[model samples]
Target: MSEEKYTLETVLSVKRWAANLFSFTMTRPSAFRFTAGQFARIGIQVEGELIVRAYSIVSSPFDETLEFFSIVVPEGAFTSQLQYLKPGDQIYLEKIPYGFLTLARYQEPAPHDLWLLATGTGLAPFISMLQDFETWQKYRHIVLAYSVRTQQELAYVDRINEIQNIFGENGAEFCFLPIITRDPFAKLNHRLPKLIESGDLEQEADLKFNVESSHVMLCGNPQMVEDTKEALKCRGLIMNRRGVGNIAVENYW
Candidate 1:
């Protein structure tokens, strides 16, 4: 990892979604630039040591401010302190952005459908991608499936709905699916791998997951990323490599 000098950014706003989930915005440095799906290393000083962690940017690249979504980990060195962030708090932001989970990664056999499957805070990067006009223009359809343990943990519901409305008028069709494993009343109540294996996910989206037309991006829990990758492979999808193939993944935890 690069130990480049970090930039100090002031927190512009913070909104709590649940007891453990929140999203915050910070001042964006003039020189900092990143694609929608990239992540930045953020630091917070605790005791005397600076603790840094990678978080996906939730704001669009065109946005003046940077935003990130996080879940508070009990006794966690980084998020435990991050949960208390106020509007004026100072946070350390690395200069460079990193990650390959962008739309540019898909090449050659161009994908007609885009699938963004995420769990918990993994939904952050997809939010950024959805806000980008290029993403709407690139594909014929886009499906975003965000899974959480319960309804309360589902963050950015309003913003996501707004994005859907804004992009729905454009060329591509946008579908947002919220999967709540612990909520029986929720529309979808199963894990992602199971949903993929059983074809329930495609059924809900009214789309099929095939190697040719679909480019699936998986993020969030490590186990979910691994298992979901395998499930897609079983359906004949391959990992995105050398700017080719159908699936892309990022392990958020």
Candidate 2:
């Protein structure tokens, strides 16, 4: 890791979600430069040892500062320490933010929707982009699917709901759908592949997933990412590469 240090200039109120799950917002470092969907490696010094983990940026790039939404995984090496960090503490970070999920890689299909499929902390990047005005300027419509184990894990729902409620009347569209696997509150109780097959996904959002007209960005648990990609491929969508097509994905696990 590079020998760099960042000061936590401010620590917003710590908010709790479910049992043992909490999120904190920290002020961005002046040196951090990242796109809406990129991630940064962060760490803290513990007994002279460096403990770090990669985290997606939850705050929009257009904002003056950065923020991240994270879960406190008990006994998790890095998160354990991070949960205790206070305002003004020094946090280590690698200057570069890198990931494949950025909008620059996707080709806009004419008059189609941009689907951002995420689960758990994977929702981070989508939050960053949805808040970004550029995303609305690029895609005619945007659909964000956030999957979690339970309804309580559906953090940031209020803000996302507000975003949709505020801008939904315009030409651009926003839909926030929460998927709870272990609870009855899920809009689509099954995973993405099942939802795609049964038409539940399209019916719920009033959109279709045609390869020629849709751009899919996948992020989340490795299993969910792989399954969603295979399903999309079966439906004729190709993975996005610099020289190829536009089905981008990132593994949050």
Candidate 3:
């Protein structure tokens, strides 16, 4: 890691959570530049020491400013005070954004369908990807499946719904499927691998999974990612590495 420049920017908004709190878009310095789906190390200069953590870039890369999605770990040394940030308060950000979650690293030449599976705050990177025009240009159909434990855990609800409506009626082929495992009111009820194995996802969504034509991206709890990877392997999907093809994973617990 190179020496990064950090700055204090205003806190745009505060989002409350069961255990953690999320802060929305904040101001960015003129020199900050990064692609969507990347992450930056953030810190706060407080109490004669620096408390910092890494967070994913949740906003579209085309945006003029910066945006990040984060969780306030209860009793956490760094996040305890971060959760109380005011609108004009300053937050720290690393000068450089870095991560392998960007689409530029996908090995496939061309894929028919792009499947982005996420759980909890793991959906941040996918949020960045779904909003980018480049994603639409790469794949004909995009299926983003997100699963959360409870309804309150669901974030970015309105914006994702808006994106669904905007793309559904238009020529763009994109679908957003929100799955709540604990809420029976949700459209789907189960983890992604179980849904994939039982055929419920395909039947309900009217989409078929073809290894030859589909590319899968997984981000979430390590268990979900590992299990889903195994399930896909049983279906003839292999990991997409620098030289391989089809599946890519960013397991962040």
Candidate 4:
């Protein structure tokens, strides 16, 4: 790897949400630029080798520092070291950002409602998108459905609530649905694809999904993305291609 392609950044802080889930903020290089829904290639040194991985940006594009949400996979090469990150620790960031999941990509048939479906750390990009002022101004209604294995894995609840409050006060219709699949006592206890298949998701949000007005963005586990895509397709929605269609997706892992 060329040194010119990446820059060294300092970790500003790290917050652990659970035994395996955490979020960290790092100093953003002065010239680093990225869209609201993009991922960054971050690296950490382990045993004299640089281990790198792609993590979706969790901070707003306008924010001075960059943030990311991560899950510590047991004995995983990159995350094992990443989970131990501390304030002032040095990490590596690629100079350029990459991703095609931004809302600006939806152009041909303009959408009126925006649906953000995510599971686990897949919620990272959507969080960044919601932080941007343009997201609230562009869509009349927005629904964010986040699913996790357990309640403990549902990260960023307070931050999501804060964003909802800030945008809702301005008349932007935003609904946040949290799904806990492992907890029987949770309000929404089914998987995302199943919820969509059963109409429970729409009923809970009080919003209908249609090809004409709904633009859906899916992220998180590959199975959830794939299954949800199939479920949405059954409802007449198509993947966004060449600036057209109703769905956009990214696989978190």
Residue 2 lDDT, candidate 4, scale 0-100: 72
In angstroms, what RMSD does candidate 3 have relative to the true structure? Answer: 2.4
Give the best candidate by TM-score. 4
The CA lDDT at 194 in model 1 is 98
lDDT of 4 by residue, 1-253 (tens): 6799899999999999999999999999989999999999999889999888999999999999999999999889999888899999999999999999999899956858999999999999999999988899888899999999998898999999999888666755999999999999999999999999999999999999999889999998999999999999999999999999999999977
Residues 150-226 of candidate 2: C-alpha lDDT, one tens digit per residue: 87788888989876765555646877778888876555778887777677887898988887778888888899999
Local accuracy of candidate 1 as per-residue lDDT tens digits, 33-136 = 99999999999998978999999999999999999999999889999999999999999999999999999989946869999999999999999999998899
User: lDDT scores for all predictions?
Assistant: 0.93, 0.77, 0.77, 0.93
Q: Please give the lDDT score for candidate 4.
A: 0.93
Count the clashes in each prediction: 0, 0, 1, 0
Residues 103-197 of candidate 3: C-alpha lDDT, one tens digit per residue: 77766646578888898888888888877777777778888888888887788888787766654554348777889999887889799889888
Model 2 segments more than 4 A misplaced = 1-10, 108-111, 166-171
Q: Clash pairs of candidate 4? A: none
Clashing pairs for predicted structure model 2, backbone only: none
Misplaced by over 4 Å in model 4 are: none
Deviating ranges (above 4 Å) for candidate 3: 1-4, 17-21, 165-171
TM-score of each: 0.97, 0.90, 0.89, 0.98
